[model samples]
Target: MVFSWRKRKPRNGDKKVHHMELEIPRHFICPIALDLMKDPVTISSGMTYDRESIEKWLEEGNFTCPVTNQVLTNFDQIPNHSLRKMIQDWCVENRSHGVERIPTPRIPVSSAEVSEVLFSVTDSKRRLDRCECLNSVHKIKKWGLESERNRRCIVANDAAGVLAAAFDAFASDSVEKNANVLEEILYVMNWMFPLAEAQLLLGSKPSLRCMVWFLKSNDISVKQNSINVLKELTSCDQLYGERLAAIDGVIGILFKFIKDPISPLITKASLMVIYHMVSSPNEKTKAELVEMGLVSLLLESIIESEKSYCERALGVIDKLCETKQGRESAYDNALAMPVLVKKILRVSELATEYSVLAIWKLSKYEEKVLIEALQVGAFQKLLLLIQVGCSGETKEKATELLKLLNPYRPGLECIDSQDFKNIKRSF
Candidate 1:
């Protein structure tokens, strides 16, 4: 121990040190598991320590990194077993409470499945029976997935099957029982499936026969439903011409309905169908309409029928007058102009309004028909109507006719001077 000059370890209480010194720990001593100071608690001395900081550290886990936070990327966080048990309990409770869970079936069955189930069975009676079965099944559960499956099935399967289902539903004695089902079927036919197949199905002999049966039915609702189906069928652009041709005497049949006092709605709808049939400027169809005495029938309906029927009949005539062929066909038919003119003179004010519209349409072929109107005192009657009986539009039309009849100067003078002044004043 020869007095080696090793640096002396300083005592805690030593006062001879010249420079001040401090120490810092090389690593953080906080527990990684808690991610914060443990056992932290406010103390009387305004200092806190381990056990309290640890509890706070654990609670801090409830919060997280402000940006990254506690987020689950996979389903593991959901605890599937726990969720499944919860759902199962809920289902049990609902069932115990007698609440019915509606199953939603997708539309259209697979084509192959539809064919196998619907088409492979050859008997028409069996086909209809199968459709009824499918419809019943669909009704009970109301499965959206199954409905979609059936729709797909119909599209893929036999075209005849789809048509058969449609026809059966339409022609069923209990349409009230099947109306909703039939509507769904029509939706698939009209909007989901290819139009060509729908047209073929609609135009098929069996389908048409079913529709005809419905048309002849005693139930008014059933008859109207059939007409609506036919209307939708004919509404397709591709089927229009062929369906018109195929439904032979459709116009005649409709005309018969027009005479039926019990079927005014049917008659009106039938006329609308006829309007569409004739709307294409088809000369042959126009001639057929004329041949069937449609112009006379429409004019009579406009003049003599109740308000609803008259309005619809007027619409038919309005459509007829849209094309040159329709106009000429209407004018050349001798019964048309005279009947319309007589109606104009005879009907009430409102009826006169429609009658004047008909007259205006007829007057468009003035070069061919005006002189005949003049001979029938149509010019004088219109002049008198303008002066006293008609409204503003009728007067304007009457004035237009007078202008056209300028060659007949005597008839032109029949327009009252006072009426002209009133018309000019109104203008």
Candidate 2:
């Protein structure tokens, strides 16, 4: 067969060389991607592919080799150094024809290297050398961002714990003084979540108090990340929530987040933090949330929230309505009835449950709520929710609500019903 090469004149003491045409050798193409392999690697199936292509396939939860259709015996990707060298050489030879040489890929980080980095950070912190700790943290953050493998290794090496110690140490003593170090730690720790151990470490009084200070930061990223880390810390531990809530102005700051949202993520996270705080909450805590206008905020958020957030906002409302002051605050809001009625069967099952439960709670104190529910088509939606599916508690709540509104069912024509599709369309 004829070759797809064009002869080139010899240079001074240089041998004759050939330049490639548009056609690339079939063997140079990755089996999976059907393109030139930038970083060719061989797998257990003896098949070679570009590293990214194979990684994408495996990341999609695939267990078999794409081309060979054989189950992967080993996940290790052994680099095809010989083939890569040849490809690099070919690219160099064909440079005049617009071919570019692929640079060598860096080696993946090893466990020992991560251990060294971890030691440097801990050693710096142990020595009370802020400058050394800052430098080491920056270096580890760079290493973590280099590759997925490096990130996994860093995580496996308890980087979150290392960062959390440094974080809590500074936060406990003087976070404001070393604001850059604290922010950098948060920036790195944001990606290393399930931070169970880190949260436990940060659950101390001083650390939690420092987080409140960070929440009031002028910088939005600092504020957002501070809340994000706080959310994680308060996720499962009610004691932490109680301590955080007791930190004067913590509740007010959360209210500010909802009243003037920094971002959608911050808003949702704030709601979640409130949700956890309310779990097993004392009478005093519930009253504090209500007095701070949490009921009206929850209603406004439910009205404005998408489906994903509506459930959380409603859940917080449901929790608040458990207390006397919470029910009173919810009743004071004009949108309370209309908004709660509108959510029944209109959002997810959880949203519907919360709406129904809130209605039941509000109607116990005020009889006008039942009449308002009937007028706003809550009766029809309650009928539909019972017909369709919902939790047993939600079903029981809907049943109870139906009995409460049974006295006003005669004016079906006046029931201002808006379907889910219509409400979603408006959004």
Best by TM-score: 2
List, residue by residue over 402-422, the lDDT tens digit for candidate 1: 777667656423322332333
Residue 385 of model 2 has an lDDT of 75
In model 1, the runs with Cα more than 4 Å from the true position are 1-209, 235-238, 318-361, 364-368, 371-403, 412-427
TM-scores, all candidates, are 0.44, 0.81
Best-fitting candidate, scored by lDDT:
2
Query: What does candidate 2 score on TM?
Result: 0.81
- Candidate 2: misplaced stretches above 4 Å? 1-26, 29-38, 42-47, 52-78, 81-104, 411-413, 420-427
Report the C-alpha lDDT of model 2 over 342-384, residue by residue, as the tens digit: 8876677778888889889988878877787777888778887
